[model samples]
Target: MGKSTASIDWLHRAPPVSGLERIEAYFSGFGYDPHRHDTYAIGHTLLGVQSFHYRGRKTHSLPGTTMVLHPDEVHDGWAGSDEGFKYRMIYVEPALIQQILGGKPLPFIHNGLSNDPWLYRACQVLVQRLDCGLDPLLEQDALFDLAHALNNAAGVNTSRKTFDYQAAERAREFIHGALTRTITLDEMAEHCGRDRWALSRDFRLLFGTSPYRYLTMRRLDLVRTLLGQGHSLVDAALTAGFTDQSHMTRQFRSTYGLPPSRWVRMLGRT
Candidate 1:
């Protein structure tokens, strides 16, 4: 018999660039299990049917459509048809959006798919190709455009309480500096010079996630970097400030939808 089309599946991780992680993949059958990550899972379906469960609904993304999965949203991926799916995704941190928007609520596109031309254009720049990465200045400009396009496409949310951008930013900075150490709401309060409860609320409103989740995401980011440099899971876990490898593993699976081993394979690192 000729080669079986059902047996085809592969994933390729683009070379890591500062503040961005990218992947191009194809699957002929099933893909990932139920998983969610702490970054904006933005991409476009290139061929076939890319299907996923998001925000309590099953969404089918067709070719030429954009997929914008929000940070911390529970979602799962797989092929919507036997022919499988092909797509490229960029996982971007909310902090990058905060850098551009400066304390505005993270934009939320209602459904997982969009035909917004501005968004499509902005995203195309980053997801265009894997071999040639964006130059620093160009990448920065792309990020800016993406941020604005997301904001415009997502529209505005009324009835949100007044938020403190400066205070939230201070807390975010503190988290970055102290990722290898224990972080607490009280400590963040002191660092941001705001009441503990108030700061927590502000952080969520401004960054689209709680302080704890933000901290964990940053630690996971470090773990990814360390692992890419050939660090063992245990070593990366310790260096990333997790209590143990198991603890890091649990968080990693919850955030990225796969264990370290599978993640390595997905990146073609294994």
Candidate 2:
């Protein structure tokens, strides 16, 4: 039998956006191993059948349906049929959602899939534009729509909860500024004028992940930038504040479902 288009796997990633990562990919067989990250994975299957295991059950995403995987959810991906599958995805930080929602709990789509037009359209606006970066104001408008659409899709109440949004934002800003050095909850708490334990709890409630994970992700973001600029892996790791290359590699795979080298290779290809 002749080789089909699905015989080979490839991926293309968009230029980086603050708080967002977008990619389009095709897979013939097994894709990512079981992994989890602290970001909202949202997108659609464009061709064939895209399959994954989420929340202890097998889930299939077909064309026209939106897949909304909440932050920190364990999942893996593969092709559901012989022809394989192609899909586009946008990884959105929950902190961005919290910024717009004023600290409401992160929205969740039932079973990690949705057919809601609101969400489908919102996702399309972000994922369909991989060829170039979005204008800042336009991106903000799109995110506002997406945040509200997700909340509506999840049927979450709009009632305000007891959260320290200012404090959390303060700590998040601090993390962004201090990614090259070690950060402690005590330091963050003091900087934000909140008790350490309370800040930790509120950070989880408002940002959908702990402070430490957020800091680590920021560092990983730096590593990606350095790698893209033609730096060696060891150089990138050290510059990004990792103990060494091995440590950065472990976190990179765990968070992104692929090693840094493979990710760069995929990006390098068409």
Best by TM-score: 2
TM-score for each predicted model, relative to the true structure: 0.91, 0.92
* lDDT (CA) per prediction: 0.84, 0.86
**Over 4 Å off in model 1, which ranges?**
1-8
Poorest 10 consecutive residues of model 1 by lDDT? 1-10
For candidate 1, give the lDDT: 0.84
lDDT of 2: 0.86
Off by over 4 Å in 2: 1-7, 158-161
Clash counts per candidate, in order, are 0, 0
Q: What clash pairs does model 2 have?
A: none
